[model samples]
Target: MTIRPIVRYPDPRLALPAQPVTVFDDALRDLARDLLETMHAAPGIGITASHIGVSLRVVVLDLDPIDGARTYVNPEIIWASPEMIVHQEGSVSMPGVSDEVRRHARVRISYHDVDGNSHPEESEGLRAVCHQHEIDQLNGLFWIQRLSRLKRERLIKRFEKISRG
Candidate 1:
């Protein structure tokens, strides 16, 4: 597996919605493997196809090695609990800064494996947060958009300062 370069923030491609993965083949599998390697290199728990400039609706998440890595193709949040939770969120695209993001405490998502087999999963806690965060990226919604304007602005400034180094 190759560690693909991450598409950093402010790249217009990150603002565009990703296309659903329709073909389940070796190439798709390779993409998944590459994503896993890239995420590990980024030191992020979750990442999406768009993170690597691939406009496909694929997500790779490795929240814990004990649970193993999970690949979700065309993942969509089918259910979200009314309860909310705040978790610190960051992006491979925008490294060096993170802020608390409010999200559903629990969520049920429908997606397919790389082999095209459909599956439904219910997640809570950090897993649930990761699901929402990555799905939003797939939908062209950056995590900072969920923060207050002031927070978003401040975070961007900090990110800019870091980027200049």
Candidate 2:
């Protein structure tokens, strides 16, 4: 597994939607492994193929390191709880910036495993937040969009300042 360079904020590729995985082969597995390595190196709990400039519907998440990482191919949020919760969120792509964003407290997602096997999982708490965050990236919805216009602008300005330092 290799630690791929993360595509930073303002990169046009991050804004583009990912293509669904059509072949679940060794290459797909390798990409998932690389994503996991990259996310761990970034010290982030979740990451997407888009983060590495690959336009593929893949996500890797490991909220609990002891439990190992989970890979999702062609992931889609199938249901969400009516109850919402606000969690501070950031991204590997947009390093050094974070803001609290409201999201479903619980979510049910349909995704495929590395071998193209179908899987459905329900997640809550940090896991739910991470899944929603990553799925947004897969759909080309950067986490900043979840923030209000004012908040997003401020965060980006702060990020720019940090980038220059």
Best by lDDT: 1
Runs in model 1 with CA error above 4 Å?
A: none
lDDT of 2 at 26: 97
Candidate 1 on 1-165: residue-level lDDT in tens? 999999999999998999999899999999999999999999899999999999999999998879899999999999999999999999999999999999999999999999999999999999999999999999999899999999999999999999999
* Local distance difference test values of all predictions, in order: 0.96, 0.94
Each candidate's root-mean-square deviation in Å? 0.6, 0.7
Error of 1 at 108 (Å): 0.2
TM per candidate comes to 0.99, 0.98
Task: For candidate 2, write residues 1-165 as lDDT tens digits.
Answer: 999999999999988999999999999999999999999899798999999999999999987758888999999999999999999999998889899999999999999999999999999999999999999998989999999999999999999999999
Model 2 ranges off by over 4 Å: none
Colliding residue pairs in candidate 1: none
